[model samples]
Target: NKLRVGLLFGGRSGEHEVSISSARAIAQAISSDQNAQKYELLPFYIQKDGYWLAGEIAQQVLTSGTPLQLNGSNIQLPNPSQTSLPIPTSPYLPVSSSSSSAQVADVDVWFPIIHGPNGEDGTVQGLLQLMQIPYVGSGVLGSAMGMDKIAMKMAFAQAGLPQVKYMTINRAQVWSNPCVFPKLCDQIEATLGYPCFVKPANLGSSVGIAKVRSRSELETALDNAASYDRRLIIEAGVVARELECAVLGNDNPKASVVGEITFESDFYDYETKYTAGKAGFLIPAPVPESVSSAIQEMSLQAFASVDAAGLARVDFFYVEATGEVLINEINTLPGFTATSMYPQMWEKSGVPFTELVDQLIQLALERHS
Candidate 1:
């Protein structure tokens, strides 16, 4: 029998739409493959309002080509011994013994493509762990650590990785004592200075991220980011090229060819990242071989530092004037959208999309074994 693979996406995150786009891409890719007969694809979508969907409803929601609507029946998380997808709990819907009962999607492995909070921060991974199902990407610890910028930075520092100067801010402190806000500002100016980036420590896809060049902007940015996550992070800005490399595998991960991103926006934000024609990429980033080698080396080191598995995209800031390569951040579940850098880099490095997907699935199975 073919290996059954469950594809999970459409999370309750700020990146919900991005996740849907990624899911659509993966489905299309898998459907068009000549070797698709080697495996059975089972799609599972988590609605934004916290509904677990599968069966014909999921198939319709995914293929309708319309905005994601909450149209599926209620379902819950499965138990380890269940050996099947979550059992639907609602009774209002009509059911026929065989014609109307909800379908059960049992799989040998799970491929979670959900990005951002509840999904990417390890909550879903933890649930799957309890279910004893093998899933793609990082585990609970790595996913949790990777989702929080403060914790991720600490791990990188522990590994002796060079990164931009950064500081963490607690939302509670600012909200409790209004006077403490000014002191926090002074501290930020003293440490990171102006032209810094403020971001929610736990979210990704550039959600709740701001580039502030003045005190007023800093305060507003901090407040905005605080609204998303309790822990906020501020980093000193750097005028350097944005280079990214794809790392794949578990114990012995390999880095793909380096790629660079350039855009007219103040920074690479959500729009530039997901919107086509908004940002430009330089494949085999026009840098010296030494710089490329350094990025690759650092990428592998960063992957090992976080104990990442399956796949990850390690980003770096290459300062031309100083010739310094500083680690930016590692995305455990980097976007697989058409405009994403992770798969693009790997494709340029000679790994086609279909082959990359096959390798990742095999890696997931290998890790479980």
Candidate 2:
């Protein structure tokens, strides 16, 4: 019998469209003749208003390549802090039923492609954990740490991985005490200096990230990022190349070839990331063999440090002047879009897209067993 694979996407995240694109790509690959006989695809979509749409509705959205429009009643955009709303108390699973009532129980395995906030930050993984179902990517601990920049950096520090100097900011502290804001500014200017990057600790896809060159910009950046997540991160900016490596497997993970991201923007922000023709990439980055080997090693180390399983993409900053490689961050459920660095790097590493997805599914099954 074909393995029934449940593909979940369309999450209540800022990266909702990105997640849909990823699911579309994966669905196409799995439905291809190469794997068509081996697996049965079942898609489930979570609407922006936090409603679950399963079966044909999900298949229609994927087929049309657009989000479904629902009635405007009681529709509110999800707040970043309140992303993890309680699951519906329906008798059947949150996913709508078809002919039978137990739609979720029919699946042999799950593949969650949601990115950022609620989906990637362990909420969905926790739900699946409660259901005792096998799913792709990291588990509760790994997803939670990977989504929060502060916790991820702390883990990296504990692992003794080299990274840029950074500091954390709490939204409550800044709001509760007026005097706390200036203290934060003073500390940032004294420690991280003029040019630094401010990011929301619990979001990705560069949604709530900004580059500040002065104290005034830093203040505004903090307010902007705080809207997305309560925990904020300020990192000392570096003049180095942005490199990424893809890691696969569970017990013994493997790192793919190093890839570099080059962009015309001042920084790789949301626009430059999703917008076409804004950035360029160099697969098997134009670096010495030794540098490539070191990056691969660090990538594997970062993956293991976070207890990530199935797959992850470890980003780095390689300083050309000093030849120093710094671990930046890891994405547990990295983007799988055609242009995404994760799949592209693996493709360059001799693992085609179909083979890559197959290996990930096998690894998920392996870990479950």
Candidate 3:
């Protein structure tokens, strides 16, 4: 019997489009002749408004490369004054008389391609956990740690991994204390100094990240980052080559060849990252064997530090002049788009995209058992 694989994508996060691209790539690979006889692909798309669309609708989104429009009359705007969180609903359960729980429950395994907040930050992982279904990528703990930059940094620190100096701020503190924002800016200037990066602690895709070189830019960056997530992370900028390594497995994770990211932009921002031709990659980065070995070792350590499983991509900052390799961050659920580094790195390391997805699904089943 063919193994049924539920492919989840398109999310409420800013990386929704990127997730769709990833799902398209994954679906093509899974449906390819190489593995078509072994697996059945079942797609599930989560709408931008957090509604779940399955069956033909989900398949159409993947085929058309467009998201389904939600009915305006059915949309409900949140209460501006409401402070309490809304009770969560299971996307796998039947939503109406026309829907069936078996659509999700009968799946042999799940492959989640959601790249940011609501999907990648452990919410979907927790749901899959509750369902007792085998799913790809990291578990609840790893996903949560990987998504939150502040928590991820703390985990890296606990593991004694070398990383750039950074500080965190809470939106609530900035809004309630009034003096907190200025105090944070003062501390950042005095410590990390000018030319630092401000990022939303829980977001990916560089959605709310900014490089600030002055107090004015710093204030603006903070406000911008705060709009996406409550926690904000400010990191000291460094002049170094950005290198990434892909890690795969559970108890014994293996790191792939190092890949360097070169961009003309000031930094690897959203545009530089997603826009084809804007960024270039040097596979098997021309670093010394020793440097490559060190990066590979650090990548495995970073993966284990976050308790990541199935797959992850660990980024680093390598300073050639100083011979310093600083850990940037680990992405448990890294992008799977055609230009994404994770699959590319693995491909350079002898695993093709189709085989990589096959291995990931196998790993998911292994982990579940």
Candidate 4:
């Protein structure tokens, strides 16, 4: 029998649309003739408002571009003894009245493509662990750490990985105590200086990130970032090349070829990352062999720093003038969309899309076993 794969996407995060695109790309790759014989695809889409969807209706919801209504039946993963498998239920699909027949088909593995917050921040991973199910990407600790910039930076510091100087802010304090704003600005200017980047601690796709060059912009940026997450991080800006590498596997993970991202926009924001033709990429970035090797090594270190598993895309800032490379961040569950860099870097390293997906699934099963 083919390995049953649960493709979970369309999460409750701001990256919901990006997750849909990722699921679409993944589904296309898995459904190809060569891969189709080896696996069965089951899609579980979590509507923006938290409703679960699957089967024919899920496909309709994805294709029709209609607002997902909560009226439909939601999916649930009951205790293992309650059902023979962890498959989600859908009102669109039929179920027999018998207890044995009420069970949905079992899935051998789960591929979570949810990009941010509730999905990638360990909440879903915790659920999967409770259900005793094997899933792709980082486990609870790694997922939680990787999702929070403050925690990730702290881990990187503990691991002795070089990184840009930064500081964190509590949204509640900043918003509630009006007097704290001036002190916060003074602290930021004294530490990171001008041209600092402000971001939500637990978001990706460049959401709620702003590059502020002045005290006024700093306040606005902080407020915007706080709107997305309870914690906010401020980092000193640097003039450097934006580089990324894809790390794969558990225990002994390896890094793929390094890639560079150069964009026409001021910085790699949400629109620049997801929108077509907004950014440009350089595969096997035209850097010295030593720089490339160093990045690949650091990529693995960053992955291990957070104890991440399955796969991650490690980003770095290469200061060409100083020849200094600083680890920026690690995306535990990077994008798998057609234009995403994770798969593209692996492709440049000679791993095709199908093979890359196959390897990730294998790693998930191996980690569970």
* Most lDDT-accurate candidate: 3
Give the per-residue lDDT of model 3 (tens digit) for 1-369.
Answer: 999999999988878888999999999999999989999998888888876666666787889787766652333323312211223653434233233222666578999999888788899999899889999999999999999899999988998999999988888755657677788788889989979999989888778999999999998888888888888899999999999999999999899999999999998999998888999999999999999999999898889888899999999999989999999989988999866889999999999999999999999999999
- By summed lDDT, the worst window of 10 consecutive residues in model 2 runs over 77-86
Give the runs in model 1 whose Cα sits over 4 Å from its true position: 71-105
Off by over 4 Å in 3: 71-102, 176-180
How many residue pairs clash in all the candidates, one count each? 0, 0, 0, 0
Off by over 4 Å in 2: 72-97, 100-102
What tens-digit string does per-residue lDDT give for candidate 2 at 1-369?
999888989887888888889999999888988988999998877888766666666777788777766562333323312222235552114433335222576778899999997788888999888888889989999999999899899999998999999989888755657778888789989999969999988988788899999878998898888888888899999999999999999989999999999998998888999899898989989998899999999888888888889999999999999999999999999989877899999999999898888888889888888
How does candidate 4 score on lDDT? 0.83
Per-model TM-score versus the true fold: 0.90, 0.93, 0.92, 0.89
- Report RMSD for candidate 2: 4.6
Root-mean-square deviation of each candidate, in angstroms? 4.5, 4.6, 5.0, 4.7
Return the clash pairs for model 2, or none. Answer: none
Better of 1 and 3 by lDDT: 3
lDDT of 4 by residue, 60-132 (tens): 5445434355553343333333322223642122222234322123557888888999888898888777768
Clashing pairs in 4: none
Report the C-alpha displacement of residue 270, candidate 4, in angstroms: 1.2
Error (Å) of candidate 3 at residue 177 is 4.7
